[model samples]
Target: MGKLTGFIDYKRENKEERDPAQRIQDWQEYDAPFSDEVLSRQGARCMDCGTPFCQMGEEIHGATSGCPIYNLIPEWNDLVYKGQWKEALNRLMKTNNFPEFTGRVCPAPCEGSCTVAINDPAVTIKSIERTIIDKGFENGWITPRVPKERTGKTVAIIGSGPAGLAAADQLNQAGHTVTVYERDDRAGGLLTYGIPNMKLEKDVVERRIRLLEQEGIDFILNTEVGKDISAEELKHTYDAVLLCTGAQKQRDLVIEGREADGVHFAMDYLKGSTKKLLGSEVDGEQSIDAEGKDVIVIGGGDTGADCIATALRQNCKSIVQFGKHPKLPLVRTEANMWPQYPNVFSIEYAHKEATAKFGEDPRQYSIQTKRFVKDEQGNLKELHTVEMEKVQDENGQMAYREIPGTEKVWPAQLVFIAIGFEGPEQEVLDSFGVETFNQKADAKYGKFETSEANVFAAGDARRGQSLIVWAINEGRELAHKVDEHLMGSTVLPSYLEV
Candidate 1:
């Protein structure tokens, strides 16, 4: 620790955010920058715990605690406190290849597991991480670290999302010839399109992609393997093939009138918004406009929240978010003790913006959509829903029961289904002759290997859709596995070895 009593001297301070009403007018990030002194003070708040759980990266009760990448939290916090910005950035980059992405989008499970959080507020670890990386870029400290030697072994990776990008970055560092294939017109899979610019600006993603390109990793965009290029072609071309194709098959709302117009998947709506912002599409051409329409977003996860934020920015008339499950407790319960991911209610930035604009929270918990009402022209007009109550079934499993007289309908011209994905699309898996462990899109691979000989799988394609941090962790670990498989040895550090 930099100072023995640093924690006692400094109280926790988070970064200031733009007012909800003002920030919703534009798509820029809502957080305002903090000065070096304030960030250093925030870093000083890290207590000298003999065993820092902040970096443990352990899964407690089926949820992640601490950082999934096992970032060197204490080390960087100390370095920052000692005015060692470059050294802190070096330590941060040691484990995480994309701190900027995680710092912006990650829910920061590390803070939930922080020892200091047992009583008082946890250190602003995510903000400090973002500051370290942003400073590195601002000072030109972050440049292309081109490998001194090439292994001459070629590898092809599918999908350009977080997991795919992380694997590409690590494999390139290992001196292997890496070429990443993306299905989209651009390189970043979800980062460039799925996420709104309000959360993560596109240029931020492009900045890192430019750095990766400088490091000798090749990127082929608008190419979908198994369709444009056959799986056998990739298998014969490269020494080894890794599938980082994300779980993108959206779960559909199978109900009456689901085929009505204006019913859309959350990703399609979100992707359309980004594409329009980038000028890829003109007005009245494939644009999912929420303007002046009663919008209903189904699902209660981060994707659903993003839908709410997007609708607000488009100036939707009214917005209502429906969650299948009951609302979580305001505080952590005994089952969710310290050092575990808390199952408590939180009003994220989008929710706050909705509250500010509508004069109340837009979330309607414990509600299930029964059917989509449509007019004669097959346009969506309203939604029928039923309230539900949670109860324990005979097998001791939790289940939802509909309330007898809670049926209701709301006017909704536009509906976005933000429910989570089931798994990766099966076409890509079947193309490679890969078998799934279960009924989902998850490939049956131990660690990350698939049924095929030299083919591998990682990230959401293998483990199902998860957090961006988990995707990075999977990518880094999978890279080490692929490197070892190719050369019979690898110098790359294994995140799980710790």
Candidate 2:
């Protein structure tokens, strides 16, 4: 370690965020970058623990304990501590292909598993990581690394999200001729659309895509594989095909008045907003304007929070979010101890913005939406909900039961259903003859293979919806699998192999 007693000398410091009240006025990242000296001091706080559980990258109790990509966290922390910025960036890029994306959005399970977090504040791993990469770009250390020779083996990647991008980056480095197919007008699938610009600005995604293009990977946009181009045609044309299409089949609220005009799927609403921000045609229709409308966002996850933040920015009259489950404890409970992802309640950026703008937090836990109430014009007018309590079912399993006579209604001119995702769209799977692992089954990792030869799947498409870090991990692992299939063996590093 560069500083053996640095953890004792330095206190944990996090990156400063822009004032929530001012940041919500526009669609831009709110985090203010840290100076190199401050970032180095933060990196010095990483203790040289014997086990270094921060990079263990294991799943404990169905939740990730550390970085899924197994980033060499301590190594870079040491390099950064010694003011070796270039060395830190090199170590960071060794495990993570896109530090900028993960640094901005990942929930930082790595920090939760940090040794320091057992008794004190954890090292600022995410912010330090962002600084290292951002400095790399600023110093021109990151450049296109075009392969010296092509393997002459062609590969087709279906999807341009994190998984597809990571796979393309790896396969291109391995000297394979890679062509990525995206159904959207732009290359980035979720990064360009599903996530709001306020969280991750569009230019950050585009910069990486441009670098990939310069490195010999070709991108074909607005071209659906199973629709615009047949899967059979791709199978015949390319040597191997990898599916990273992502899990986008939204879980619907199949209650009454689901056909109301102002009710929309979360992705549709998010994509529409992002498209309008980018000056792109949003399905050739105007953006879903939440201005002056009472908004009700269902689901208590990140997507729902994004909806709340977006609505606030759009100058909505009022905002309320509903979560089916009970509120989590403000601190980690005995059941969720160290090294596992702490199931504790913490405010995210969007929630902070909501609180700052609305004078109170907008989340209401243990509430379930019963149905949408619509006006005569068939537009949503209100949302009916009932408070729920946890109770034991007949089988002695925990279940939610509605409190009798606890029904209530809230004015809602627009409703965003952000419940969750079921899995990948079936059309893409059916087209490729792929069989999905039953989600009900007790499998840690889902199936990634299709019935057809040389066809593979990864990320959300195979494993269902998950974090960006997990998606990158899946893409890197899948790339090695595809490479092995083509060359009879592979030299690509597998982070999970640890």
Candidate 3:
């Protein structure tokens, strides 16, 4: 530990964001940079508990808690507190290959499970982590590390998302020749296209890609497996093939007038917005402008919240959110007490911006979208919805039941279905003869081994849609398994220590 009494003497601090009114005018990052001294103080708040639940990738109340990659949180926190930034960076990179991405986008489950959070506020773990990495980059501490020798074994990985990148990083460290194939014009998968640039800047992703290129990892852009190249061809040419394709199939809304012109999937909207911000200059053609439209986003998840924020940037006239579940309590209830990731209310940055502008919370809980009402031009005009009550279905599964008297229509020019993803896009999987473990598709997970003997899978493709941290963890773990399958043994580190 850096200081014996650091936890008691120091208080937690977070990096402040820019003024909402000013930030909404542009698509740039809004977080104000904090000084090194303030970040060091935040790091010192780590209590360094004996059991250190922060580093333990535990499952509480059926939800994964703590760091999924098993990040050495306390160790790095101490290193940062002691002003040994280089060492802190090294310790952090030991488990997580991309702290820069997770430090920005992760919900910080570690903070939720922090020992200090039982009564007081949790240590500013995410802010401290971001600072350590940003400082590392500014100080020229991060550099490419090319492998000493080549193992003469080549691997082909599909998808350039976090999982695919993590797998490639690990296999390359073991001296294997790794090549990643991406369908998009650029690499980084969702990190590049799906997520809005305000949350994770495109330049941040480009910098890391540059380093990976310098380290000799081959990235093939605009090359899709099932379309341009055959999956069988990839399997024949490489010693091993790892499928890291993420789940991209959007869970759809089946309702009246669903095929209207003004309705779109959340991914389509997010992808278009990011492309526009990155100078694709196609927003005018593909972008749905909320400038003079009343927008109602269906589903109140991260993606939905992002849609709201993006709409605000476009100067939307009005906005409201629909959440199927009841509002969460301010604190954990008896059912979600301790160690578990509490299902509680959180005003995310996007929600905060919307509320500030709209003069009320933009979300409506326990509400379900029933249908889309379209104008004479076949454009979506309004959302017909009703309040819902949860009840058991015929299969003994919990499902939403619409309340009879709560039916109402809200004006909406643009409707975004942000329900969630179903599973991996099945085109490549079916063509490759890979069986998915998930029922939604034909591919199988867990063994990760596909229908073919040498084919393996990981990330959202195999495990279904999840957080960036979990995807990285799955990628790192699968690399070890694939390495052993190819070479009979390996030296790549496993993120899951247990």
Candidate 4:
């Protein structure tokens, strides 16, 4: 530890964010980095514990506890505290392929599992991490690490999301000629489009893509593997084919009025907004303009929050987000203990903005959507919802029951369903002829092998939708597995080491 008593001496401080009312007017990132002095003081708050659970990366009771990619938190914290920014960046890059992405979008499960959190406020880990990488870029300390020699073998990776990008970066570094295929006009599957610009700016993604190109990785955009090039052709052309295609199958609200003109899936709405912002051609059917329309978002997750923020940017007349589950407790319950990601209530950026703009939080918990009502013009006009009560079934499992006579209708011209993804899309999986079980690619985690030989799957495609950190873990592991399969030996480091 940099300072043994530093944890006791310092109180936690987070990054400063733009005023909610003012920030909602633009698309820029809301949070601002701390000064080096403040960041150093924050870094010094890392306590000298016998064991640091901040990097454990375990899943207890299905909630992510720590850094899934096993980031060396304590080491980097000490480096930053000692004014060793370059050393901190080096340690950070050793584990995470893209610290900039995780530093911004990651939920920071690492903080939830911080040992210091058991008593006092946890260290400002996320803020310090973002500063370290942002400094690395500002000082030109990070650059292309072009491989000196080629392995004379080629690999083709499908999809260019976090997992695919991570795998491509690792394999390219291992001296193998790697090519990444993306169906979109631009790369970055989730980071570029799935997320709004206010959260993760597109330029940040572009810079990394540019860096990867300088390092000798090829990117082919606007090309779907199955439609443009057959899977068999890809299988024969490359020594190994890896499917890092993400889980993008959106779950729809199957009810009456689902086909209403203004009703849409969250991804479609978000993608349309982002594409329109980027000046990409968007068709009439794809354009889900929320301007001046009363909007209702169904789902109680980060995606729903993003939808709320996006609608606010679009200048919607009114906004409301519905959640099937009740609001979480203010503090951790007995079921959720230390080192387990805290299951508590915290206001997200969207909630704060909504409160600032609209006098209320705009979230309605324990609400179940009954149906969407359509106006005479066949456009979505209203949403009917019923209050729900939590109960335990005969099997002692938790379930929700709708209350009678509690149905209420709210004016809603636009509806976005952000109920999360079921799993990876089936079209790509079918093209590759890989076996699937329960909507996931039938592939082992450590080995990352799919049903077919000379092919592998990882990330959200292999194991349903998850965090970017897990995607990085699987991507790096899959890269190692592919290298082993191709050359029968690999020296690429994976997430196994702490």
Winning model by TM-score: 4
lDDT of 4 at 22: 98
Clashes of each: 0, 0, 8, 0
Candidate 3 least-lDDT 10 residues:
437-446
Q: In candidate 3, which residue pairs clash? A: 435-443, 435-444, 436-442, 436-443, 436-444, 437-443, 437-444, 437-445
The regions of model 2 sitting more than 4 angstroms off are 284-286, 438-447
TM-score, one value per model? 0.96, 0.97, 0.95, 0.98
* Cα shift from native, residue 216, model 3 (Å): 0.3
CA deviation > 4 Å runs, candidate 1: 281-286, 437-446
RMSD to the native, candidate 4?
Answer: 1.5
**lDDT, candidate 2, 57-145, per-residue tens:** 77788888999888999999999989999999999999999998998888899999999899888899999888888889889999999
- Compute the lDDT of residue 415 as modeled in candidate 4: 91
For candidate 1, the per-residue lDDT at 118 reads 90
| lDDT value, residue 107 of candidate 4 | 95
**How accurate locally is residue 388 in candidate 1, as Cα lDDT from 0 to 100?**
97
Q: Write the per-residue lDDT of candidate 3 for residues 1-498, one digit (tens) a residue.
A: 546677788777767998877788888877877777886777788885888777777666567688888888888988888888999998888888888898888888888888877877787888778877887899999989999999999999999999999999999989999999998878999998887888888999999999998998999988988889998899899999998999999999988899998888988888888877777755443576778889888888999999998999999999898998999999889888767776899888888788788888899999978788888989888878889999999999999888899999898888888999989888888878976556313322336677787888888888788889888988898898888888898787665445
Error of 2 at 268 (Å): 0.7
